[model samples]
Target: MKMVSYLVRHHLKMELRSLHNVMSLVIFALASTYTALQVLGGKPDPTTWNALAWIILMFTAFNSASRVLPEDLTAVRAYMHWTVPPRVMIIARTLHQSIIMIILSCLLLFALGLFLGSGNMDTLSIFGFLAGMILTAVGLASTLTLLSALSARAGAGYGLTAVLGLPLIIPIVMISTSFGTDLVTGVALGQTVQNLYYLGGLSIAIGIYGYILFPYLWRS
Candidate 1:
């Protein structure tokens, strides 16, 4: 456990230090935010705007996943292999990507708040909105991290990551879109509680099991 935490910390530091990946994520997020605002126009119906936010978030997440795998050009990834257990490295990268994703989500939500109106913006509902975003971010990050580590593209890492990340994020898109719309429309918790539970459960299951298997996947 300690080792995993250590590796994750180091991975996050390296990720933060990497100008290329950080800038790419920011650019993609800005583009997505701009597109989402255009889709919203002035004041879109709450439901339509809510769905647009999820769609934009999903695409941005996909674009960020492209560069997740450590660049093989440097010996850094090679040294990590010798020092840290593969699982630790995998979890570390996953955490790094997850943080980037959550940041993007917050940016998108903030942009939406500025340009689009949320008909229902209460404390409990805002909590629910954030809850949905967390689940989506973690689930997508872990799944994409595992897929990229396993399926090494000789050169086309970006294209391959997209193919692998898309299918995994689809279910998340459904749950997030539904919950976001429900929150915007002032729907009762009872009405949308099932979607929330499903997302939370899936996120936990995937984060745990995905790491356990990724060590083997990374090996072969």
Candidate 2:
């Protein structure tokens, strides 16, 4: 537990120190939002707004995942292997990515609201939608972080992560989009509670899979 916390902190510190990476993601999200606004030529309907937000957040997650385990150099990996347990490292990385994705989700939401406008959502509905964003971020982060590890170990690069990650992440995106559409379109939170459960369940399930599978990948 202590080692996991230390590793998480280390990941956070490294991310904060790399100003370019942080700014790049922010720019990417804002640029994507601007492009969306231009393409639509105006504010989209509630469903479109929800889908666009999810799409931006999804790609942002991909961008973030591509940078996971930046210590891909053999010497650094060897040092990491000798010092930290693989399971602990995976947990820490997933936690770190989840934090990152959640923040990015917020940024994307804000950008979308600023440029494209949020749909007609009441306070409770907005809160429910925010919950969906958080759960989706965790699910995407866990799944992509695991795929990133697999891609790194295979020496196949970011393409492998995208190839392996996209199909697996569809269900998460679908559920989140559905829940979000409902919230934005004026469906009551109580009615869409099941989708939230599905999102949370998927996130936990993916994280557990990564936790169980990483040690073997690390050894290789």
Error of 2 at 164 (Å): 1.2
lDDT of 1 by residue, 61-169 (tens): 7776766455343365567657777777777778877888888888777776766755456777776787788778878877877766655624455677777677877
Candidate 2: C-alpha lDDT: 0.88
Alpha-carbon shift of residue 111 in model 2 (angstroms): 1.1
Q: Name the TM-score of candidate 1.
A: 0.86
Off by over 4 Å in 2: none
lDDT of 2 by residue, 64-136 (tens): 9998466566789988989998989899989999998898888887888899987778777877887899899
Question: lDDT scores for all predictions?
Answer: 0.73, 0.88
TM-score versus the correct structure, for each prediction: 0.86, 0.96
